[model samples]
Target: MTCRLPAALALLILPALPAGAQSLEDSAARLAELLRAGRAVISENQALINDPGLGDKGLTPEAFLSQVTAAFLARTGSPAVSEDLPPFQRALAEAQLEAMGQTIAEAQPLINMEGVGFKGFIPAVFARLANERFGELADGRAAVKITAPPELVRNRKARPDDWERAVIEDRFLSAGWTRGEAYAEETGPGFRMLIPEYYSESCLACHGSPAGETDVTGFPKEGKAAGDLGGAISITLRP
Candidate 1:
């Protein structure tokens, strides 16, 4: 599920912007580049896992997460996140962990599913990028999204908040999306994207079941669709 941080909540947590800082659009562009890079890395890892000969050693999912997590740490040059994730993503990540754990431990078993998943980790990667770019970590419902006219995915938009909304609409008038710095601002510069089933399938294991639907701590329970793309991560900007 896509995590969304409302604009109002961001101001309460994000640090003040620096003088002569980049406009929210510029900062968001740079952040999107980082997010794309991270996504590429995750995609590459998934490809490696599915490679024909890589499984000769019989690697376990735990081993895969260990190696991949280590590579992520080494690549980013950040401290380990053993005790807990940075404050901004703690609640979000923890909830994900619980849901994922429950899926891996029970749901999958009852349903006879196999193969550990990966794409679902975008939120974590987004958090990492937000931390590096903004010097602040956003937690559950806190995140950033890149947006633009579909024709101008390359041409940056001055309306940063609009782009955040674009992500939820999944109608980036532009070519594609990138990542952005997670922050806060007056009127809450950015907006949040609601997660619906359309964006992911793993989300169903825990979120689809009636018992898990309304009770998931960090997720929304109503007006969501089977394939509905969730809300965007809102961030306040200097511009």
Candidate 2:
């Protein structure tokens, strides 16, 4: 029910929806956007989190949620929790936000630690943790996750399953597929959607060149360039 989402993809996660798309996809996509926004806020404050001179960076759940809202608005040109959302959609969105808030609040001590150059609070890690909380909060009604190609995976828990792997390799990574497009369909389980993410300039610092060389989190770089198929945000809604 929980999985990993890639780091540094705030700018490239959402894709334009097709006309008359299913409401399920819309709701799932919006939840994915919110999760990405949370990651974006965390990425922007990496310096503060790693500041050895600071004891309290002041990124409480409320403060962080405000930043996440602003980030979502700036990126998507829409309010994160729009008033017009259906009751179900709004409920699920709020649950996702609540999950994120709880996750960050619980990490307050670690994030504000002194003399720590890198607390390893990167966007990917935050996304993964938040998603874990989301699964529990959502109570099996929905789930969100980020995962990547097999060779690019660092956490075994983040490994994409057969469904995600097939979509990533046969669709998202296909040269003919449209860039930034999301793929969705209902099959074996529940309704599922995956928004493709590319390696942006920001992602290069950790996921970029000098293949096999260790990056900040001690993972080898994927040597990927900007615009390469880096990962996907996977969403599932129960039937």
Candidate 3:
């Protein structure tokens, strides 16, 4: 039931609703409720992934993904997308996202902002997920090597059958958001989901600035000017 929604989105959701679709206050309230449930979906699964007891009990990744995803499906009332996933892969993604969440949470102490908005975390979270799941993060030069097809990254306005930009703008650079068979394309063959993090002042310190005043643990400094990247997350799926 742990849904990871960017705080900025909470503000954006209201205006975007269909014209005269429903009462704004009521619609916002409902969205908030559903989002709360979605967040719980992530949180609960993360706990399961981390529980040594579950692992010790011979709970395999497949077994866990099935159990946890079922829980999420039930809570959010979303279609059971996990059935399309190999149980092992599903569990791996769940665990990876959990770990990424932890990394962002840890960075909280270093942050000096009102709240860590979600838009900024896309790259870091994607980096963390790639490292945990794919091994060796792919953000800078490495990402260019694993480039997303031009069709996918370009055409910012087109909403294809599969794949969507993490944000409309190019500034929030999380390469993992657009690359990978699992996330970038949907040929009815694999997994896909955009797990965006809320922006934190700490994130702005790096992504926001062209010349980051401070250096992340692994990345070196470049330039300054990028400013608070506090905005979006969109994912694609296959039926």
Candidate 4:
């Protein structure tokens, strides 16, 4: 299913900004929305891999994700700036778009490696490799990670980091939020972050089941429901 940000949640997440920074905030919010949209497209398309028509096409999940990203960007007129924005806002928008593109590029290979079958060891091993390569491409300016809570994935990397644990605990675990998107400034200067991810029907194959059952990958299942939070795609930015 396509995910839509609730209006109330959107309003709550918008940062309070000074008049001078309002334009920049708007630009940032727009970029975050785009990132969320891109993720949703990937999720929905990935879920379709099992369809008779789509399955016969023989495209791997990663390849399908890349195709969807390209089509979404093209349809949305991405990399285009509003002419009315001031020079600074225009520049900020352009930079954010570039970073988003680079992040997608780096993520695609990892998703490709995981494939569609949720097979043994491939997902876990390639997920680590993807994170390593993404770290190299991010080059200290930003970081991206895909993780689930300890109860779900049972891997060290699946555990949320200090920056993320509280949010996951409160918003996802406590409140039953299946999907979320947010942007926040870090304690340090010029550092901010955006996170967007959600659960989907296909996630149930591995994550949903008897708690101790072995999945296709021989990993213990989480006994999660269809709408349970599968994991997150978190992107931290230095800009």
The numbered model that scores best in TM-score is: 2
The Cα error of candidate 4 at residue 204, in Å, is 0.9
Candidate 3 to native Cα RMSD, angstroms: 15.8
lDDT of 4 by residue, 120-218 (tens): 323334344444444454344434566666566566765677656666666656654545655455546344443545556666777777877987767
Ranking by TM-score: 2, 4, 1, 3
Q: Write the per-residue lDDT of candidate 2 for residues 12-37, one digit (tens) a residue.
A: 23232333448888788888889889
Worst 10 residues of 2 by lDDT: 3-12
Q: Number of clashing pairs, model 3?
A: 30
Error of 2 at 36 (Å): 1.3
Residue 135 accuracy (lDDT) in model 3 = 22
TM-score of every candidate relative to the true structure: 0.32, 0.89, 0.26, 0.54
Q: Write the per-residue lDDT of candidate 1 for residues 1-239, one digit (tens) a residue.
A: 25545433443454543433343333443333334334444455544434443323233335434444455466655422333333323333332222222322332232222344332333333334333333233332334444322321221331234544544345422235332223323344342232211335544543344532552334433333344333333333332
Q: What is the lDDT of residue 152 in candidate 4?
A: 62
The numbered model that scores best in lDDT is 2
lDDT of 2 at 224: 94
Q: Give the Cα error of residue 177 in candidate 2, in Å.
A: 0.3
Candidate lDDT (C-alpha), each: 0.36, 0.82, 0.33, 0.50
